[model samples]
Target: MREVDLDVFASELAEGAFAIDVREPDEYRAGHVPGVRTAPLSELGAHLPALPADRPVYVICASGNRSAWAAERLEAVGVRAVSVAGGTSGWARTGRPIVDGTDARSA
Candidate 1:
């Protein structure tokens, strides 16, 4: 799994990069990148087919661990994916915007 700095991740997002958040529903509900898809690690296999294969998907979580694991799994199956180096915390700390709404993931 490749690691990505928040700047690169933000730039990629601005340029319309695809992203997947591999955190559990509860964690995702707390907060996540604005354009990221919620594909929790537990359900990645079923959700993988829904993701675009041609684009680089940014995998993220509260920390970097779960996303990295998801990245590895995606790469193993030939999906182009990378992990956000410090995950959501990094993005939040870097002043990147976040979607402050209800926890949609849990529902």
Candidate 2:
């Protein structure tokens, strides 16, 4: 429903914000924020309990589009979620820590 910058998202994560990567498993396997959980938009409903409602859930993907849509879906289902502006690509470019199958550090 709202937007957040990569740096702000990073700081929020540091402060314990709940982050979710609403991308395909393969895409997420390629790369993602170090602490974000993989909660694909396609199956967000059944996994709603896995998300913490007390805090805002930050959503991200390759770009921000899908995450934005996912944010809307999350809103429809009463979950407070926001799409990070520019998503993972922006996070990567912002020098935030990320993790992949073989790498688990800043990029």
Candidate 3:
């Protein structure tokens, strides 16, 4: 599995990379990156098919732990996945704007 710093991931996201938040619904509803899809870690297997294989998928969580686990699982199945270092917290600390509940998905 690979890992990307929050700063680098931000640029990749801007360039159209796919990203999935693996946090639970409540956490995600509080705030998340705009346009990022949600696939809570608990249900990742079911969501796997929906993720694109042609491009890399970036996984993130409130911190990096859950995403790291998800990235490893994805890699085991041959998806080009990377875990976001520092995760969503790092994004907020960097002053990135997050989309709130209106854009959140049910997990």
Candidate 4:
């Protein structure tokens, strides 16, 4: 699976790239990158049909591991996806804005 560092991910995010948080709901509720939708890795298959076919999906998790796996899954099914290296933890550590709660749209 393709991977991108936080800086590239952040730049693309600013351009409105699609992103999915692959961490579980509780973890996602605790904190996440602003505007990222929840699609926990466990239920990812169910979300496939709804994913955009024309754009690259940026996948993230608490750390980089799960997102990497999620990205591979997405790629196997013809979706272009990239895992965010260092994931949300790195994003938060770098002081990027984080949103708390289940509301993915609350930015």
* Local error of candidate 1 at residue 68 (angstroms): 1.0
Q: What digit string (tens of lDDT, one per residue) describes model 3 on residues 1-107?
A: 99999889999999998899999888888999887889999889999889998989999999899999999999999999999999888899999989886976532
Kindly give the stretch of ten consecutive residues in candidate 1 with the minimal lDDT sum: 98-107
How high is each candidate's TM-score? Answer: 0.89, 0.88, 0.95, 0.95
RMSD of 1: 2.4
User: Of models 1 and 3, which has the larger lDDT?
Assistant: 3
Q: What lDDT does the true structure give each of the candidates?
A: 0.81, 0.81, 0.90, 0.90
Q: How would you encode candidate 1's per-residue C-alpha lDDT over 1-107 as one tens digit per residue?
A: 78898889889989998888888877777788887878888888888778787778788888788888888989999988898888898889888877843634421
Residue runs of model 2 more than 4 Å from their true location after superposition: 102-107
Write the residue-wise lDDT of candidate 4 on 64-90 in tens digits.
999999899899999999999999999
Q: Candidate 2 or 3, higher TM-score?
A: 3
lDDT at position 30, candidate 2: 86
Candidate 1 stretches greater than 4 Å from native: 101-107
Q: Considering summed lDDT, which 10 consecutive residues are worst modelled in model 3? A: 98-107
Task: Report per-prediction Cα RMSD to one decimal.
Answer: 2.4, 3.7, 1.4, 2.1
List of clashing residue pairs for candidate 3 = none
